[model samples]
Target: MARLLVTPATGALPVTAGGMTLSLTDPGCITSLAPWRGAGMALSKALRAAHGVDFPDPGRISTSGTTRCLWAGRDQAFLVGPAPDSAALADHAALTDQSDAWAVMRLDGPGARDVLARLTPLDLRAQVFEPGHTARTLLGQMNAVLSRDAANGYEIMVFRSMTATALHELTEAMKSVTAQGGADPSPG
Candidate 1:
């Protein structure tokens, strides 16, 4: 019997495109934190002490030290950083690993939001959806967790199976944005 081994290929992900820098990221950890029954306060506090970030408010993202937390759902958020393997996590909340279940796409540039707007229903205005914002929104029919990493950058997380579709949508949208003069490179 012959068996072929296939490893995840980082090179397969797309690269920078016109007016936008798009790349896939594999975070070291994506741990979900949810209160066990009525331990919301305790779990929130424990996560703060352990990861240095309070449980993010709904539709928000919080970062501290080397860890970043993004709101996942009602009373739940995902911590991306060191794996939640320490003893402290056992006493905090129900923990689950989602690192391998999703693909992280980073889009940053002058027109990152413009590109996203073409694909998602999200209103990517800097005023209402500025940095530190996190929301579960739809991107070209895919359910995605969108987080603003900076004023000109965002992290879009889609199910692993949808990575291809997400990339295609984002790429096409970026092309449209660039064509519309959102990212012209011509010098005056």
Candidate 2:
């Protein structure tokens, strides 16, 4: 009999091109929290009590300490980082462990937005997609959760099975952005 070991989606290493870098990020734990009908408020309260994070509005990401509550879609949010108090949340919402279902990656550096622009249709301009803004969007052909976690930085989450494809797409975009004289150095 042989034993197996778990591995990160991107080999747990950084990939760089044209001054930009992409790396795997361990968010600790990811839990899907879907509120039951009419229990939205209670779920929010329970989340606050458990993680100190408010339920996020559509297209927003809320954070407290290392925990982030991101609006995943209508009536659904994902709590990334730290395990939630399931007992406290069970009455208000359905809780499912999603830690192994996703591959979280961090993209950063000067031309990061430009690199992402090649893959997604959403506007990446800072004025429009400021830090803490998040969206359910397409990254190339895969479904992804995109968030502007900081200026010149983004957090991209996709299905664990699609990580290789995601990496290929982003790398190609990074190369293209680099070839096209690189990203504009101005802050927008």
* Residue 18, model 1, lDDT: 68
Poorly placed runs, candidate 2 (over 4 Å): 1-9, 185-187
Report the C-alpha displacement of residue 92, candidate 2, in angstroms.
0.2
lDDT of 2 by residue, 101-138 (tens): 88888999999998898899988888999998999999
Best by TM-score: 2
lDDT measured at residue 45 in model 2 versus the true structure, 0 to 100: 91
Local distance difference test values of all predictions, in order? 0.79, 0.88
Candidate 1 lDDT (Cα, 0 to 1): 0.79
The Cα RMSD in angstroms, rounded to one decimal, for candidate 2 relative to the true structure is: 2.8
Q: What is the per-residue lDDT of model 1 for residues 1-188, given as tens digits with 9 covering 90 to 100?
A: 12211115335555666656888776668888887888877877888787788888899878886789889999788989777855887676888888877788799888888788777898777778978899999999999999997878899988877877888788888878887878534321
Which is the leading candidate under lDDT? 2
Residue 96 of model 2 has an lDDT of 84
For residue 7, model 2's alpha carbon misses the true position, in angstroms, by 3.5
Error of 2 at 125 (Å): 1.4
